[model samples]
Target: MSSYFSSADLFRIAPLVVLSFGAFCLLLMEVFIKGAWDKARTAGLFTLVAFVSLYYYRGQFFEGSTAFQGLLFTDPYTFFFAALILIGTFITRLLSDERLREEGVGAQAEYFSLLLMCSVGAMIFVAARELIVLFLGLEIMSIALYCLCGSALWSTRSSESALKYFLLGSFSSAVMLFGMSLLYGLSGTLVIPDIASALSSMPAENMGILLVAIGLMLVGFGFKIGLVPFHFWAPDVYQGSPTPITAYMACVVKAAAVAAAIRVMTLLFVHGDLFSVWSDAIWFIAAITMTIGNLSALRQRSVKRMLAYSSIAHAGYMFVAFIAPETGGLSAILFYLVTYTAMTFGAFGITMIVANSFPEKTDADDISNFNGLGFTRPMLGVLMTIFMFSLAGLPPGLAGLLGKFYLFNAAVKANFISIAVIGVLNSAISCYYYLNVLVAMYFRKGEVSPSHPVGMPMAGALGVCAAASIFLGVFPSKLYEIAAYVVTTF
Candidate 1:
């Protein structure tokens, strides 16, 4: 049999190629450059160009296609995730520029290149229609992140965080791969669609093999989303890594994994014999993840750690969307992801700004550093307030309110009313810590100076994220439409 590639498939996979090529070019540029040049400028420009190209190719999304002999598939679902990752890269790059300068690391060209590579991996992971491809894409993303986490050469905390992340991440990957192997052994194929089709008729075959595979996969996904039991690494890593990278991991990486999980559980599982067996476990995890995340966040003095815990809670919210039988849950999950991204990136952007002003002390993790911030830097205080309010699920910051509303609504329709109630209570508990920051900023007074200046690059990034949060909070219909379209396309 002669194998031929399709042009439509090529077009659908264009964004991944563009990002990979851009990263490659930047890597080569970093090698050739001499002495003390600003690599961030080069990297940022390349990232922006790549994202613009991706946006241009957005028109190609609705037409579904598969490539590499059906190893990867692209539809509106993939396009939505690809758009998110690219935009995430653009924002992270801008924020990283100043950090690189502060550390006296002359060329950030390589760092940005790695970020682009990571974005490519994340996009490909969501588009993967086959098991081998999924594993490969995940490793590509993980390796890049491992390196990025430790890139702050001057910070000892960065190195430690990287080590812990690497060890735990490697362990999770091993379990996931073993599960995939078992799944393949039982199904005689590694393609997701084929596996689903195979499972439909294999009543006598050991479902245990598939269960192990999915269970291990869940462990990996849980780690990525920072859910309960597997969430131990997030607080340390978030506090220790460079702030911008932490923000990137919190928003973009988590979103990609959740998006992929939505496909795997809802789309693939619905067609397989595994659905009945998996639903209970999913419900249990969702409940524990939400309760534990909210409870743990309440006592955190480190602002970054608190946010890390909150990210886990957000994952729990998205997790509940999976229990709904209909694909409406998917729309809710995707919309929540968009809102989460805006809120989180905005929060981290403010932290990044504060880091520049008090590099020796602020550290971006200390909650006390924020005391009387409203009196010192009014604009940053206001932006931080927006992030906090949005995160707390309050109005004018739609991330919390709208995200939780849709999630709970979907659960109610699915007849998981009790689950929805617990979810709402979890959201309410989450408000306490998120609002604590606001209290610190507005109510407390301190002796610190108010004259610290904000870096232009960092400020610009913060402004964009803040604006996105408020804009989406006010009129979320556009994003909901896009998310709904993506869910239906799959």
Candidate 2:
């Protein structure tokens, strides 16, 4: 045991150590400390912590090594996603501090601690090198998120979301495990690279089992990525969970899941014919997902549910990166994830702020509630406009437009011309709803009421989001290079 564990392993897992320490400290404050905290002071502290964390984990890095006896690995790929997951978590925490401060006893501690726990899990998830490690990492992430969804005990919808997520999430996990078990049986290996080595020259008789295994695993992954047909849970869960957590699910969890999927697809299914078979499946799924997602979003009245369907559409966009991995596809996906995070955080944060203007217990997220928001709250309206346009893949939303450029460019390079065309059509379809939000804010008239002022922490979070979206668009070459570097190690 002493020989198996080493200092290098410690370095490999340092992010988890740091996050676990944060969670433990927060838990200690909850148990040992007494009395309610000062809400403004608490929000300030959260903002400061997020600022400090950003100072350390602000950018992606490229590096590589094996850890935990090759059960887990450290690489530029993992580090890139680790940076993303932490940044998303910090911003979500800032929003949580502002939103949950007025809630009952222990809300702050539980919220912060569990978020840290979930980040740790997400880090483990993307760093996994073996199937069992992957399953364990995913379970850790999922269980923590289930608790986070219901952290708002005051809302029955929150409780319902948690229960729904747990039951369905468990089923998906089981489906993945069965697939993993079959893959192991066919290849006689749990290690991903070893399984890939075995699969490079698979016999015809074993191909059937291999296809079944791959299909099952993809089904499991579809739930996490919010791909259509498997995306039924997303709108309900995103709508019912606390708004900040909804954004977290949209950004952080989706990033982790996509990273994990990239690893599996890039490393495990290497046989030429087999890869083609699944790639074709992914192509069709992407088309249906993008079409169905945008069409469904067009009908939604609630902002959260609309964004939920939008998340599904984005998942389809993620699959476009999968269409041709040989031509810088993963890097395109990485860039899109980064920009999508910026746009989504700002959009959802503004939604929360605007909805707060209405009296409690009203249909706070109705698109109608956003009417006249531009005239009433000019700054928030401007921020939301930036996010919505970016989300719609329009200009001044340079981040989103460039991200899509990279994705569609990769598809064309790989000769998947038809799928690229479908994606463009879907983008046009999405503009209807994305721009509809802006139309509500700037053009429509509703009985607008006075809105609550944003807390310092939330404002800071939104500021970071808006700045990142614009900055990345203006200076994309360097970040795109960094993203390209990430997949080189793989």
Candidate 3:
């Protein structure tokens, strides 16, 4: 490798530089700046830098350019998801503004900085072309989140959730690192495609270690994606964390991990020789993940925990696309992720509002607290209904419905019709629990009522989400066409 750095490399990574330095500037603001609207001003700084960053991630550079002597690269695959990370982070900040005031938390600088840095890490994670660089990005994002989860020092659940995440996340990292080491040893390469190239011609004696490497890495990513059996941490973590951060985990975190998985898995499936080795394993994981996620969600009374389980099921849906990557799976996954972001934030945003309206207690998030809410808060009722309907894959909730159509269509195209049927069945199973919240809000009356006032930032954020759910559903081609083009490039 050349010791010299080219301008092309630097230009390609300029967006990340802007974001990383922007994060640093935010931390410095604590010393150099202070006053009323401090957070508002901080948010303004973040928004300014973030949009500048997005200017590049959205399309400033040609796809397929590498930075850092090929350790990181620019491509439509990277650009699309990197842009999504920025969008998700911006929305999270919008949602968090109100919560920050409500919690009256100290060290506002650290809080917003971590959120910004997490987005930086997520972008790097999705852009990385080498295993070590990928791991670096993953750790940067994971460590930021571990600390963010515990930032609410007033709550013991917050502390506990942080510890649990830190410990388990560390273990999964170890497992994944070891798997990467094994792959490196067997394939004698660290670049993912090179690793796949070397593995394709491996001697029969090394097949065992190769299989072990694949399985171990799947175990590691399964923890990150919340596949069933590896999902013990999700419901607890989601319920215990602050609501905005919970939504962050559901949207940005899941999207980044799955995008990385697609890169890794694509190398194997396209290579053909090794496709069957993991094909059956992915199928089983997808089946059980969808089944268990929906079943567990059905039992949850707390909206947060239910959404946690719902996230797991969505992971399974993405895996269905994996089964047919050659048959529009990648495009479907990209489109589904966009719709998933809109639907998820919409649901969680309203859930936060309804809970925030009542007394401050653990049970405030309970669906029973939402009784007769449709009558009292009609807007919230309508928005929440749109989100729930989308998640259930029903009509007028057309985002979820169409997202599933693309996913299952890919599966059918690949001749993997069985899993498509199973996915459809799971979709039907999910409807009961998703709609139950609507029953609580509209059909039942209870003592709970909105006692506190709210702001437009959240409403504004939710309105964007509702529009996405409806607009994207009616005119799928608008976003789907770009997603398809990006996937073709991938």
lDDT tens digits, residues 115-148, model 2? 8888888888898999999999899899999998
- Two-way TM-score contest, 1 vs 2, winner: 1
After superposition on all CA atoms, what RMSD does each candidate show versus the true structure? 2.0, 2.6, 1.7
Candidate 2 versus truth, CA RMSD in Å, comes to: 2.6
Model 3 Cα lDDT, one tens digit per residue, 1-490: 6566776666667667777886788788777775744664475466567667557444534556666777886877777887788778878887887766454346667888888888888888888889999899989989998988887778788788888989998899889999999998988889887887788788999988888888888888888888877989999999888888899999999999998888776764355667776678878988999999999999998999999999999999988888887789889999999999999998999888887776466676898988888988888889999999999999889999999999999999989999999999999999999999999989999775745566777778899999999889999997988998887664
The per-residue C-alpha lDDT of model 2 at residue 51 equals 36
Q: Is candidate 1 or candidate 3 better by TM-score?
A: 3
What is candidate 1's TM-score against the reference? 0.95
Candidate 2, residue 278: CA error in Å?
1.8
lDDT of 3: 0.84
Locate the minimum summed-lDDT window of 10 residues in model 2: 53-62
lDDT of 1: 0.80
Q: Which ten residues in a row have the lowest lDDT in candidate 1?
A: 98-107
